[model samples]
Target: MRIGMMVDSYKPYISGITNYVEINKQFLEKAGHDVFVFTFGDLDYKDDETNVIRSPGLPLADSGFYLSMRYSRQAKKILQTMDIVHVHHPFLSGRLALRYCRPAGIPIVFTNHSRYDLYAQAYLPMMPEEVTLGMLQAYMPPFCKAMDLVIAPSAGMGRVLRELKVENEIEIIPNGVDLASFQNASPTPREKYGYKSDDILIVYAGRIALEKNIPFLINAFTGIAGAVPNAKLLIIGGGVQQYEEEIRDYVAGKDGAKRIRMTGRIPYDELPAHLSMCDIFATASVTEVHPLSVIEAMGAGLPVMGIESVGVGDTVQDGVTGYLATNDAPSFTAKLTRLCLDSELRKRMGRAAREASKVYSIERATQRMLEQYERLLREPGRRKDKLYFRLREILQRSLR
Candidate 1:
């Protein structure tokens, strides 16, 4: 089947969503399906068999939302030739797909990877909580209801959709990891980082943003170091400029401040080695749908500790694969301390985590997504063309 996968961002700008698309595209193409990516920004990638379309009118920062007009034109032309148009996010690309593909009678499948309400709350902190929640309540239901099929990466996210009164059929499909690439890689020697072989390395890999709750991780590590002297925290990835200073100051205030290492943004290829070197991985973010960092840590056989936030429950099994803490500094500190103090527990949990991660392999995820696409294509009332324009006009009127 010919498929057009639309996303707001793609490679070179790494995130969970971009990684999901790239991994799934590889598996889909390998399975003999013709796949194309319609996204923003210039991708430094080449695939002779797969097509990648770069849409226009993308803004400097919020390029994803800014592409509605350009994507409308680009999507109409490209989606016309495809059997299914799969949208990664339910914003501009999704709107474009619905507007163009629906009229042409092509089925559109949407994946809700991020919790829009939580995301809006983080990015637009100046907005009142009531206003953000109100906007989400108003916006989510109809957008979900309009899609041919809606897929949520975690059951928690699926529940959120149901609560929003989204009448459309919703499926839970967790994001996939490249198990082969992440598993059991030899650690890059720690001599470069001035780590002794006996040092317990804790890694936090993801965008260092306010929403990620990095400060909590730093605080938790401070508590951990009070007990375990050789413990070190590796802060990976990058974000706003101020976060660096925030992290620096936090670490400096601690007695073992020099143990904290910030690698800025490591290249993707080196991630496995970095993961391999770590004894434990942790994240405090409550906003993730299916955090790729946690999955990658699992793939590397590292014991993970994080908040028992909605979708995250599916990945981290308390006292089994990894510890799941409540959303508090004490809870996170206790979990981190447990993992750091118990080597045997870490090893056991790491083994379980590796086994659990296999379930989210790229092949399985791609097959599930393909099944959803095929099912949607065969359903009745699947309009091919002109429905999007009509729907857009209706939605615009309602919003105003």
Candidate 2:
């Protein structure tokens, strides 16, 4: 089958969505299927992968998103030849998929990846929450209904879409993780980072942005610092320039700042070894849509410590795989202290976490996704794609 991945951005702009498309594209190609990625701008940027189709667009600052209403003629010409197209971002890429592909009688699939409602609260604080929700309620349902299929990475995210009044059927598919490297990961020596073997290392990995509640996690760690002197924190990610600077400044002035290590942004491939060095994986963010970082940490044999919210709540089994605390610093701190003081509990939960993470492995996820794709194809009315490609082949031969 010929598959096309539609997104607002790609390459040099690394996010969970880009990673998803890139990895899945590789897997599908390995399975002997033709795959292409259709994206906006970055036309001047060189890609290290094949079949990454770029079209012109205006860059949206350094946020890694491009803005344009229509794709280039060449992109539109090739897009209509695909058997199916999957859209990641709902706003730009989603609408474009509908505009370009729907008229061509191509099937479209959309995945809700982030908590956009919470995102508005984080990025546009001056905007009223009710207004943002109202806009989403008006926009989401119809946008989703127009697609052939809608997917949510977690059941919690499915609920979020329903709350937005999208009554359409939502397929719950967890984001795929390349778990092979993580499963066999060897721990990097803590001594290399200036930590003793006895010290309890707690790590947070992902974008260090406002929505992630990085300051809340740091404050909670400071509280634990006095109670459990052996507990240390490792933050392993970076985000927007202003937000990253704000977090760095905040951590710099804190009383127990030295105990917390911030390793800006590291390559995704190195994450498993860094996570293997930690005892617990922690996140304070309430705005998560099936956090890949937490799942990846679990794959590295580390238990998670997260707040009781949608994506985090859905993934972590409180008191089983890891502890889930109310979205408050005091509550999160108490659990952190408990996990820190008790080495045996950490080991037990870590084991359970690793076992649970197996379900989200890339092999299983890609197979499930492919099943959905094949199901879409089996439906009638998609024969136009075949005829279009056949005629194109004939025309090329005639010109030759």
Candidate 3:
């Protein structure tokens, strides 16, 4: 089988979507299937893997995303040869697949990995919430219905789509984690990062973007640091330089400034070692669709305390593998303090977390995705190429 993964952006961007596409490509190839990445970006950017087809697009500053309406001539030609095309980003890549592959009888699977409504609120705060939600309601249903299959990374996200009036049948498939690299990772020595061996390190590993709510994490940590003097927060990701600088400034203004450390973007392969050095993993972000970082941290044998919503709520076993608390500083700080102060509880939960994380291993996830692909191929009326296009035209005319 030849699989094409379409994304708005790719490597050097360091996002969960990028990681997902990369891992899937590797695992699928190992299973004797050819995988290709179809994306828009700098044509000069070096890809670490083979069969990555890039089309030129207008660069959107340093945000690592490109704005392109259609694929290059070569990309369009190669993408048509694929048996299946999995789209990660809905708007850009989704439309491109609808235009090209749908006519060729290639099944397109779209995974809803983002909470676009929340994202719109975060990025375009000036936009009214009503308008944002209304736009989503108008857009998502038709686009999702057009695809051969729609995938939601977690049950929580599936519910979000249903609420948005996306009446299509949705499949719940959790994102996969490469557990081997994290399971027995060697931690970076405490002395190297200027931390004492006794320090109870709490780590948050992801993009330092607005949607992540880094300031909220800092606020929660402030309440915990006073209670547990040895507690530390290690932010192990990077983002727009301005946002990183803003987070740094906020941390500097806090009382226990020395307790906070920010390591701007580590290599994807070296992530485990950083995770291994932490005692607890914590995140306050409510905009996750199956957080791969939390799974990776759990695979590294670290207990987690995340906001009780969506992906984090689904992944964590609450008081068993970790604690899931309300999205408040006092509630989250209590859990953070509890995990940091009690070594035995951390150990027990860490063990459970490691065990629970096994279910999301890359191999298992790849197999599940492959099963879906095979099912789609064998099912009668699987290739609704003409039907979908005809319906789209009708829907568009009716809407207008």
Q: Judging by lDDT against the true structure, name the best candidate.
A: 3
Question: Which candidate number maximizes TM-score?
Answer: 2
Cα error of candidate 2 at position 176, Å: 1.0
Could you give candidate 2's per-residue lDDT for residues 1-400 as a string of tens digits?
9899998888878777787788888888999999999998878888888888888889877777889988888898888788899998999889889888887678899999999999999999999999999999999999998999999999999999999999999999988998888889888889889999999999998877788899999999999999899889999987777778888899999998999999988887788898999999999999999888889899998989999999999999999999999988889999988999889999999999999999998889999999999999888767756577558767986999
Q: Pick out the ten consecutive residues of candidate 1 with the lowest summed lDDT.
A: 61-70
Task: Summarize candidate 1's per-residue lDDT along 1-400 as a digit string, tens digits.
Answer: 8888888777566788877787788888889988898876553455433578876655565322334355545545766778888888777787777777776778778888887788788889999988988887788789877877888888888888787677787888988888888996888799979999999999999887778888888888888887999899998887656766687677788777788888987887799999999899988899988888899999999999989887677779999999999999898898889899999999999999999999898878877887888777677655424356456656886999
- In model 2, which regions exceed 4 Å deviation? 384-400
How many angstroms is residue 68 displaced in model 1 relative to the true structure, after the best TM-score fit? 4.5
Which residue pairs in candidate 2 collide?
Answer: none
TM-score-best of 2 and 3:
2
RMSD of 1: 5.3
Candidate 2 to native Cα RMSD, angstroms: 2.2
Can you give the TM-score per candidate against the true fold?
Answer: 0.90, 0.95, 0.94
